[model samples]
Target: MTGEGIKECELIEWHIKEGDVVAEFDRICEVQSDKAAVEITSRYAGTVRRLCHEPGAMVQVGEALLEVEVADEPEEEEDAAAASALGPMPPVQQLAPAEQAVKREQAGLAATLASPAVRRVAREHGVDLASVQGTGPSGRIYKEDVLRLVEAASEEVPGPSLQHKLPEQRAEQLSRPAPSAAGLPAAAEDVIIPLRGYARTMVRSMTAAGAVPHFHYCDELDAGPLLAARALLASDPALGGARLTFLPFVLKALTVALAEFPVLNSSLSADGKALLQHAAHNIGVAMATPTGLVVPNVKAVQGRSVAGVAAELARLQAAAAAGRLGPEDLAGGTLTVSNIGAIGGTYASPLVNPPEVAIVALGRVREVVRPAPGGGFMTASVLAASWGADHRVVDGATLARFSNVWKALLEEPRRLLLHLR
Candidate 1:
């Protein structure tokens, strides 16, 4: 599994179990980080002796995950002779009475039939191996049995420690109504599905976004030229019938504006004493996946032409919807753009993805009546553009100026072509 900046991940499932023979590079388990779920593969061919962690356990990077019993490689004659000269090894110690009893209950082995990994899991959850019934060969306890015990315990009491409650108080707590689901009152027939994986991560990230000193800057852009540009691109044979969208134009314009206002392309240091300016214009495009929302950025957008940006955006959107986005695709974003307009929103104060200073939201393009130079009202296509910036690094005035530049480029779509790489 890829760790990179991830410190720990929840063990989601095990593909290989104890006593199962696995080949090198065979997928052994699935672990989910905040960003994505990844499959962990075996590094050596061997029989799985024990699973170190159970499903739903938070395992840290570099931790031993499982124990494997592999045959030792043959040693050379010189090494064997050197080992023999060192004399015979000492005898193994006998088990204590309590240990002997535990060994008998768990399985009749020289040591506890459970491996160190399984023991670690049992210790973490305070599960007694002597009480659990093992289904493995020779009554060897497995990780699944421990998980089943934990799940059963959780279902008996859904929340809070009732042990300290008085008899009357416990009755009152149990009589209270169950919590709502998805902000709606639960009907008797409603199925309560808990958020997990990407959805859970999104909730945490959005909560952190709320804690940042943030402000919004919104303005309308004349979308007549943008719409024209889209039409022109759609007619070009070079496009190969690929659907051209307003997102590439918006992304390109934002990249150009970022070059002018470099502060918007930087993140604040953790201590808030310094600004970290990124050299590349990696702009994240927010897209909704079936499981949750994901923002996989197009790297180095400052160097890509409109067509290139469009191609990359299409690739990323497809990968994200299919839940196949790689770690790199979801990282290194200096700014983000959320096209809520595609979903029929007029405007939204999109949340800033942390470490980045700003995010821009594009609302749907619609017709608006405005005064013409001749003093007559004329209808023009317009888009509501909203900007959210971390106020710690970007002042209101700086964000306003940046938005003006982005809006201007979109209003005069030809200006964007001049700046394209």
Candidate 2:
């Protein structure tokens, strides 16, 4: 029986007692769905022998939820021959009683031995894992085994080429229950979880953000002077040739502007009654990673100079890219910024990082021509910005003012430099 949508995604839940007797096709468990939970029906009628999961727990799809004792019937000659004719002789040979026991162990090992990446590689390559010899510690079939087999096969066939498949499309070839170094129980099925790390946070944040009426303010800003200033600074030999980004400038302006609009940097209480305001401007920058999303914050952005902000951002970026950031780096953000432009996106309505009232997303800056006073065309870089605000904490007028200030500071790049104290 398959339990649907039990925990996150890829986990199933058993709803019945372990030893409860069940009829064929009877509903025994529920599974997770992309939309909702679905019930799983038993395939065979029998006395319930075992239950693999508890309530509120997650188990992989296709994992045996419960075992059953079925009445045995003597096999007929025709039935045996039909069974033999269905599968290849080698697969059928594995059905022998002793071989069945070995197959169970192999399946268990295959479940545990390979890492997520190794499994993907094996699957894409069409390698039969059971045939590959284990070379990992404790007889585990590691990725090397797959590559070794591929190499051997390539050597055996002398030709212009050996047709091959990617590791993910290939069938699994490894056995089961290869013990990990930490000796935790091995995952026996392919259960995926959507509730891990940033994905988990995104779910919670989206719910909260959606609950509060959100008002967005969008604007296009001219950044000709900002780009010129960046070029001048980058070319200067005294500045150590560190590249300048729009983020530090934006961060500087926003921190200063936050003083005038303090509510935008505040959080709503869990009870949803009181507004929790803080004096510190700990700005969180959203970073996307292969595992999931993580937002690491820079403490006390209010008084930091442009150089100071740049240096701190560089450190945070390195730590995030290397996955070395601690739990503390993720906490205590009063406001947030997400840059979609880096990934080639323009103007996305970003969800507010709760309990913060507002979040900003920076879009790509590109060259655009505007009519000059003398009827000649002039080229300037255009940058798009979107601000998602909690209506409970701030209104449309405030959001527009914030965007206006951000645009003004970036356009007059020298004014931004002069205003930095």
Could you say which candidate leads in TM-score? 1
Clashes of 2: 33
Give the alpha carbon lDDT tens digit for every residue of 1-421 in model 1. 4556766666878898899988788888877777776788776666777676778766656555776665463332212211210122122234555665576757644334454445666665666777676654345556777768767777897874554344555677789787756677645632335565577778988998898988988899889988988987876765555568988888899899988999999988889899999999999988987778888899999999888888898888887776668778887999999988888989888889998989988899899899998998999998998889999889999999889998899899999868878
TM-score, model 1 to reference: 0.73
What are the per-model C-alpha RMSD values against the true structure?
8.3, 18.7
CA lDDT of every candidate: 0.76, 0.66
Q: Which runs of model 2 end up more than 4 angstroms from their true locations?
A: 1-195, 235-242, 418-421
The model with the greatest lDDT is 1
The ten-residue window of minimal lDDT in model 2 covers 82-91
Model 2, span 1-421: residue lDDT tens: 2122323333345656766877777777755422223466666666665553455444433333444666463333212211210111121221444554476586664324443445555675666676676553234445667778878887887752314544332233233345658967756755334364346667777786787778888888887787777776755554344456878778888887788778877988888789978898999988886546778888888878776777788888877776556555777899999988989877888888778889999999988889988899988788888889988779899889877876787788666665565
Candidate 1 wrong stretches, greater than 4 Å: 5-22, 27-31, 46-130, 135-173, 177-186, 189-195, 235-237, 240-242
Tell me the lDDT of model 2 at 376: 90
